[model samples]
Target chain A: MVKPETLHAVLNAKTVSVVGASSNPDKTGYQVLKNILDAGYQGRIYPINLKAESILDINCYPSLLDVPEDLDLVVIVVPAAAVPEVMQQAADKNARGAVIISGGFREIGNVELENEVMGIANAHDIAVIGPNCQGINYTPNKLCACWPLLTKRGGMAVIAQSGTIGATMGGWAEDEEIGFSALLALGNKSGVGEIELLDYFASDEETKVIALNIEGVKDGRAFIKTAKSALSKKPVVVLKPGRTRKGAEAAQSHTKSIAGSDKVFEAVCKQTGLIRAEGICEFYDYSKILSMLDAPLGRRMLVITSSGGSGILAADTAEDLGIELKQLSTDIKDRLKEILPNQCVVSNPLDLTGDATANRYMQALDVAITSEVIDCILVIFGDPVHKASDVVRDISSRTDKPIVVAFLGGGDVEKEEVLLMHQAGIPAFPTPERAVRAIGALLKKKNY
Target chain B: MHKLIGKALADEYHLNEAEAWELFSDYGIPTPQHQLARSVEEALDAAKRIGYPVVMKIVSRNILHKSDAGGVEVNIMDDEGLSEAYHAIIENVLAYKSDAVIDGILVCEMLKGGLECIIGMTQDASFGPTLMFGLGGIFVEVLEDVSFRVLPLSKEDALSMIYEIKASSLLQGARGQVARDVDAMAELMLKVAIMIEDNPEIKELDINPCFVFEAGGGIMPVDARVML
Candidate 1:
């Protein structure tokens, strides 16, 4: 477990000092300070540089001790050997937390130097994020401590092993309109890693879902325990790469040969209730749905599509992913038949026909919400249906039942309406398979 | 620590097949009734006590792959057959590994009419002790249809491992076959979990071809191996 005070100081620090802050835009130190300024952080920003008197129009100090006020957090971007001295300076200045963005530590086999930095932080009881990480983003406070600045704010908190992947998730949030609460790029992980971050984000009120893109865990047992604890409060979606890697080399038994790290990681996910995403798209798609909608009452999905082909695609994907598509009972089928056209099918997919209008969607959605059998609904716009976004917005606001939309093949209409659906807090996918995959992510929560 | 494991650890060698079976019995993991026979007379007596249709395999620390070395003989239904099997195993083992130290033969009741499954444990670098389960033989060798759960496993975790494999449907009486004793398999898994947790000295364990019988018939481990 992470110390509450440490997490609080790192995430909600009011006064932050950037050690090794530079004047050149090409340097990482300068860009970090610029990102902090551009994020419109309400807190005071202190830039420390030995060579320059000022950076980016802000007065710069020669050392952390030269700072006028007490520092709550320190962002260090100095060389690996300089990090220990900066940490010592941070300790003397009574900084509560530090984010070390420099990368020459343990990653490059500089173990002794990294340990020396850790020793300083530990001795001072100061919480440290990394000695070799990209940095962090706490959107609620408009703090973009890392590079490749992203300020769009919403609900999901992302923690990734690679900074590029973290930025990619942020990019997705910016494009999809479903933003993030926080993002932490854990490089080398010499200090705080996934376990501590998971413990912190699970209780974060602003965070509705936690997304993790990790290569491996340091301690599997500790991870399992922390993940289980987090799952009790909010959903955690994880994408663990290297599923094809073989087991350890010193295998003596058949069990050891097959109990590869990937297989064990899968088991850990299953036991801890972590939603395991297969790819980057699924990771974001899962998080998007989790951050937006509540878990449906059950797995029974009622897919309302304008085309049979789209409906079939949904059924196929849902089947592959273990999302149930039960046949509609005769009573509900008859009710749907009365409102639906005679040519429309009264099945689980409930093909509304490619020519079906937006009004037909509302009718089917109405029957789905009232029906005790239908736990969730998937709406597909197969053509340029008029008022499709309006139908989705009106229908979603009217019910608590989970709803996902696939606004594909509607040309410019879909391109516009999909954005509207996202703004309405309704998960909308560009394809039917992706929409069904999103629904599958929501259904995974109930089993654990 | 179990004396067998302590000895294996001190000697810096894996436990023989018979010793492995004994260690499994000590942990309450079900094993077939049997006894180590040092002589032809002892082999006959052991076969009579364990009943007809017995399995005889060479027990030697030097020879880990008994079947591959032609050190195993099965279905000895009479005293004559048991005696011949006991001698043949010794002869075949010597031919496979000339300097192998023969530790007598393991004569045990032969299992019949059950699904072959494997349940074992190995120390994982990150996860520590992890238990694995899957269909035995070709399924585990070729298809790699296995599932793992890190110890100490809960009832739910153990049960989930049993159903997580690709061939899990076969345990549920797929087609017209009677459902195998999944509860028994789950129970055995829990026992193995506890065993592995209590004995960290156990570096690796294998119970290949564990016979899982009909719904109420229970499961029995036919062969076992332990590396300390």
Candidate 2:
């Protein structure tokens, strides 16, 4: 375990300095300085550039020694060969932490570079984030230490080994309107890796869910321990990229990482209660659902659909995916039978048949959701003829049970209904399979 | 049961073919019909009664690995070979076990070739009574491909064990070879596991070359050894 004082100084530092800050806006150093100011961080920002006296209307210092007071953190955005000297200067200035947002270190297939970078960080007694990274972002603290374009909020702590993937996830989070507590691009992971970030997030009161996009894991045992501890507090969703042999080799070459056997990793995930997402989209999609909705108590799914064919397809998919099509009790079935014609299928899937209105959809949901046998309910709107927004509002106001809405068509129903449902705290997916998979993941997490 | 033999009841014992068959009958493992012979006359008589193309071996309590010690003689066709083999067996058995008591000889019908396999049981420290199944014969150790399940396994458990081994694909008709009777093998392994679990005093048991014939033909235990 890292010391609490050290962890605090690294995560909650007040003052920050940008070493190797450039006057050129095209350089990464200038972008780092601009992002910090744009995020409205309350900390003092000092840009250190030897050639220029001032950059971005802030007076620039020639070196770390020229800084007058104790600096809390230093952001290094210089070339890989010049990092050792800059780190030596940060050590002299006693900076608490440093974020190395430059590439061409150990990730460039050089062992000597990795050793030198680690040596510098160790001698300085400073915790480093990355050598080839896109820095960190803490929304609540107004700390935008990354170069990615994103709007920060407080819900999840996103950790990724690849900077590009982390930036992409940030973009997705912004577009999806899901807030994030912290986003860390753990490039190269020479000093600090997922285990440290996981430990930090395990006790963080602001973080609700941890979304990780990993190409490979360094230590399996430590990961299992940290993940087990974190999952006990909050849900930990992982999207491991190198599942196949070819993918594992590619990941090894890309990050100098070791990818373990996929079967063993799957078994570990099952044993440790870490939810494994299928793809990149599902990774974010499931995280959104888990964060926004309540966990279903059981696998008994009650799907209410307007189209009979869609209802049957949903039923078949549920059965194939090990989800039980819950049989509505006698009272609920009798009520549905009285409300509908004799030709309607009044069993588990409760098909409303064609030519259904908003009131009929609400009636089916009310009847299915009140039953004691059903654990979750899926409402599929097939080519909505009535006002879709009105039906969504009525369904959202009615029940507190976990509901996933699937919009079949492509027009306003998909765009408007999904937004209304999302805003109402109910997650909506485009297809029933995705919704079912997300609900299944939530149920598994709940039992775990 | 012909009073069996004195060595068959000893604390440390080895049985010849006829005595081993009697012991196998006692344990409910089937063995081929055979007879024992003492001299050249008895050898010829046993051969004629058991039919032609019989296998002969020198039988002694002290000599367990008969083939390694040159005590086994196979496919004796007629009286001339039987006469020469009788003297050869005596010489070999006497040379192999000079100080021990010797049984005369074993003459039995030759078994046809089939898919060979091994089934055995050993007490694991963590989980007791581990049953093992693998491809048998000389290649058993070389291949080192095997599967184990806890003792007293059900038929389903036995079938799962067979499918668990890495080389199980070979038994499932790999390389255009005929598939063996795996169901029969599973049943036999389950029975053996149950027997071992029931009789805890028996420390180790090996049924090597449990020849499993092609489809529709059942498996049979050709040779077995047990230790307490």
Candidate 3:
């Protein structure tokens, strides 16, 4: 029953308005208006401010009613108490959606004011994003309604409960050049909640994978149903903080005495086909790996390493994660032996020693990718190797199988190899354990 | 089934063992054949009818843990042993709790030893009814070796929940022991799922030490504590 405004109008509004538009470049109002212009939004902009004749060289209106035409979206950056009036005005002017970037409201326990704004938005059929939010974006549409800092468009969509965390994740994606299709922040959640947004992004062509940072859910059953439907077409990675005792202390289960637990959430994810990330870092790690490749058919992983220790560590982590490490048969071993040195161990963690070169890594990768048994490949490199970047190139072009790499140890050589893989659209981690985790996210046998 | 549970909870916070067994039986769960006896004479007669050697335990609404308070007596070989044990149970329970109200003694045929497993239901405020399955016995929770899934469970979910526990190997016959009946256990789980699905007011259900016999022997719910 709580359907949001057509996401098309909210994300790709042709006629936008910025109420309480600021002339000061340092203010949030100014940043929001500037970001829209900077993101190249090819739409009409109206600055609703009585004090300014123009903002960012765009003509300004005294109020929403003063505008000559209906608006598709409105970004409100006024004080909290002033939001309901602006919302009422936007509704009167037939604005389809309002992205309120103001603070106060339910976030500070001001439920009365939040309710008044929600009532106004609902009555006028105005879909509000926030009263206190970090704002939102749709990079493909060049609609950056969020902060001025922006990244290009990609297939991953980040929906986080904490605006700060969402911004940090967006920044990391920008830094790593991992583009995002959409970045939606949930402010006090007095407006549209996560479930409504999930339904919108589930079918969004630009969003191939959806990542969520949730503190808690208001409606468990509805959330599960929404997530379950979304999961059929794309991967939904969730990160819910506060499960430990310390985490529990911050939250009180207002329901029953048995208490709410992360275990039940974990079990729900297990049943609903959603992926649960243990930490913030793992959320992006999963997104990076998932964005790079499709889901593997089976959990059978093949580890190809130049160092024995890294290989063993990967095997152990893979086993702990319940991923089956396919033991290379003698026939496959013989094929590898033809290219690797005599001292190389032709086993499951098919290690080609410390002195092994990129040729050996590629030979093993080539054989594994060609094997009918292997479902995915995990390549590890430590110490010196010949053209580590070449291994990434061969894997990226030669095979359709999902590939993840671990460039172990440090130094410019190792760092360069990791960056090279990222540039080639391959997910590479710094440690063997991390690489194994990345593979586990995509290659696990039983998923929701 | 709800009426039975309601009547049991009419004046008490919990159900007596016999009433709980009735609810389990209504859901297709098997229980040992037994009858309640109000006196030593009735206890001896019920024992004879049920076919001794039998188990005679105090059936009191106040006595939550029967065995702990020396309220249970087993292996009644004859009328004399039955009479002696019946009086001893009453005396011991009254001594344990001076104000305790003794209902009667439940006389039943002794069950053979089998694979001990446990099944339970706890209503999480957020998730509603959740079912738990693991190695059965009183200390099941202390071991903390259990897996849970929100109900109503499908046949597939029920089967997986059974083996998802670490103690599942014991159910399949560990250390030369006879392999217990797994299908019977899965069936029991589904039936329990149905029972809870019909009633949401049920706060917790404790059916510990469910005995799963050798293949084809079926299963039995030995003890239960149904709370509202």
Q: Which is the leading candidate under TM-score?
A: 1
Given candidate 3, what's the lDDT at residue A55? Answer: 92
Candidate 1 segments whose C-alpha is farther than 4 A from its true place:
A246-260, A329-347, A354-357, A384-387, A411-416, A446-448
Task: Sort every candidate by DockQ, greatest first.
Answer: 3, 1, 2
Report the lDDT of model 3 for residue A130.
74
Task: Give one digit per residue, the lDDT tens place, for model 2 in B1-228.
Answer: 223434454546644556656756665666665777877898899888988788787677777677876777888888898788888877877777777566778887767767888887776532356677888854459866776665547787689778867777777888998888898888788667766666665567788768887876878886666655
Which candidate gets the maximum lDDT versus the true structure?
Answer: 1
The superposed Cα distance between candidate 3 and the true structure at residue A58, in angstroms, equals 2.8
Could you give candidate 1's per-residue lDDT for residues A201-258 as a string of tens digits? 8899999999998776668778888898999989999987666634233221211122
Error of 2 at A275 (Å): 1.5
Those runs of model 2 whose alpha carbons end farther than 4 Å from true positions after fitting are A1-8, A307-313, A337-345, A353-357, A384-400, B1-228
lDDT score at residue A47, model 2, on the 0-100 scale: 89
What C-alpha lDDT does candidate 2 achieve relative to the native structure? 0.76
Off by over 4 Å in 3: A251-259, A341-347, A352-360, A383-391, A408-424, A445-448, B5-13, B68-70, B95-102, B137-139
| Interface C-alpha root-mean-square deviation, candidates in order | 4.0, 10.8, 2.9
* Residue A415 C-alpha lDDT in model 2: 74
